[model samples]
Target: MRLTRGGKQNAKGAGQEMGGPDKEKLVPPAEGTAVPNGEETAVPKAAEPGPVTEEDRTRSEEGKSAGEGGQEETALAQEDGQRRPDESSLRSQLEAVQAELKSALDQAKEFEERAASLQAERDEWAEKAKIAYEQFLRARSDLDGFRKRTERDLEDRINRGKADLILALLEVLDNFDRALEAAQKTGSAQAEGVQGAYASADSSASGQALQSFIRGVQMIRRQFFETLAREGVEEIPSPVGKPMDPSLHDAVAAQEGGGEHGTVVAELRKGYLYKGMVLRPTRVKVIR
Candidate 1:
């Protein structure tokens, strides 16, 4: 087998290699020199005067970045210092606004409390007024009822008292009627004897005395009736052959008489009227 040689310098264990020539070493041509084949060679960069390590390059770049950051921070601090008074004024204004808001809230709460208290008081007074009004209504109703009842009772009492007095007077009138009837019957019988005796010559003392007694009884009966009339007492007419009035007449007996049916045949007892009202009914006989 044949082995090919790659370079003129013999490399030792792939660590070092010899460059091709001065052209490969990157040497710049002179400024006025013409380039070979119309192609210009690349200009070589100037070599660092001191050999800089990787760590030193990194350190320098970091220092340059730090300086630029510091300058920016200083400018920001200067601007913040210039605006410090304005920031403080804004803070004070905010605090004042908060205080005003708190004061307004407190006033509103106080107003609400006052309104609630007034509402409660109004409710209480309204309830009292309602109760009083109800009581007044009840009292008025009771007064009306009482007045009506009292009037009714007074009328009834007056009527009863009148009735009692009239009844007592009726007893007296009845007795007088009975006495007058007896005296009239006696005088009539004696009158015939007196007339016969007086026609012949003179009347007897007993006959004259009896006639005088009858006249006196008649006058007393007439006087009693006149007094009753003055006291608003009147007779309810219950004549025979007259129409029977159930309101003023009570039928004591039904008989066939000289009158139409349902007519007053005879009045047995008298009836009285007082103030246009029937005080007593007439007891009468009715025709059947």
Candidate 2:
């Protein structure tokens, strides 16, 4: 029995060694473990993320610059729109000034045309007045010439009438001279002696009266001849010895005579000249 008991103990000891739990093993804690009251709660752990690359940083900066540029362009467009109306108004004012200048030039040209026409009319009137004055001067000269000619003709006619009146008075004086010459020739023939005695004895008482009368008549004839000679009445020369001048003599008869050709033979009636002009030609006989 002792041996058998020892074998069992040994067996049990081996089993015990094989079947015992390990003393080094961990145990789970209780659900409400106590912590310090003032301490903060536990933070969640951050998840692991990707690293920053060069291309991602560049894209972010470009987007920020483009937004700022868009704002500046919109402001400049508004300012250009405001200035457009002012430029249009200034162009309209310049066009109006040019139209006014053209109107003034047209008015000045019209005034010049009117002035030229008035000057031409004045020159024409002045020329006409000068021609009229020249015509009046010519007419005055012609009238003066006619007046002088008329005065000269009137003076010539008056002188001719006075010459004709003087010629008629000269003819009456020539006839009175012939009567006195004939009475002187008869008285001289009676004065011869025989005829003188017969003429004195034939008178009776009346004869004595006639003899006294005859003597008285001889004295009257001598006185009349002497009075005429003193007063520029003289006989033309009719000599028997000289040649006959036709200007002073009228031949009553022709005869063969003692003198030369065309000589005076005898005087029939005496001729007289007054102031070297013939009053009457002498009547005479001439030798042919």
Q: Against the true structure, candidate 1 has what lDDT?
A: 0.76
* Model 2 per-residue lDDT tens digits across residues 1-288: 112333444544554566552233333334575546744445433322233334444544554465677777677767766666666777777777778777877777877787788788878888888898788788777777777777767755653453344334334443444444444444444445335435655434444455665556556645654555564445688656577788888888889856677888888777766446565678888888
Return the top candidate by lDDT. 1
Q: Candidate 1, residues 43-143: lDDT per residue as tens digits? A: 64532223334555555666667788899899989999989989999999999999999999999999999999999999999999999999999999999
Question: In angstroms, how far off is 28's CA in candidate 2?
Answer: 99
Candidate 2: RMSD to truth: 27.8
Models 1 onward score TM values of 0.51, 0.31
Residue 178 lDDT (model 1): 83
> How many clashes (backbone atoms < 3 Å, residues ≥3 apart in a chain or on different chains) does model 1 have?
0
Error of 1 at 286 (Å): 1.9
**Model 1, which residues run further than 4 Å from truth?**
1-105, 154-158, 184-197, 200-233, 274-277
Between which residue pairs do clashes occur in model 1? none
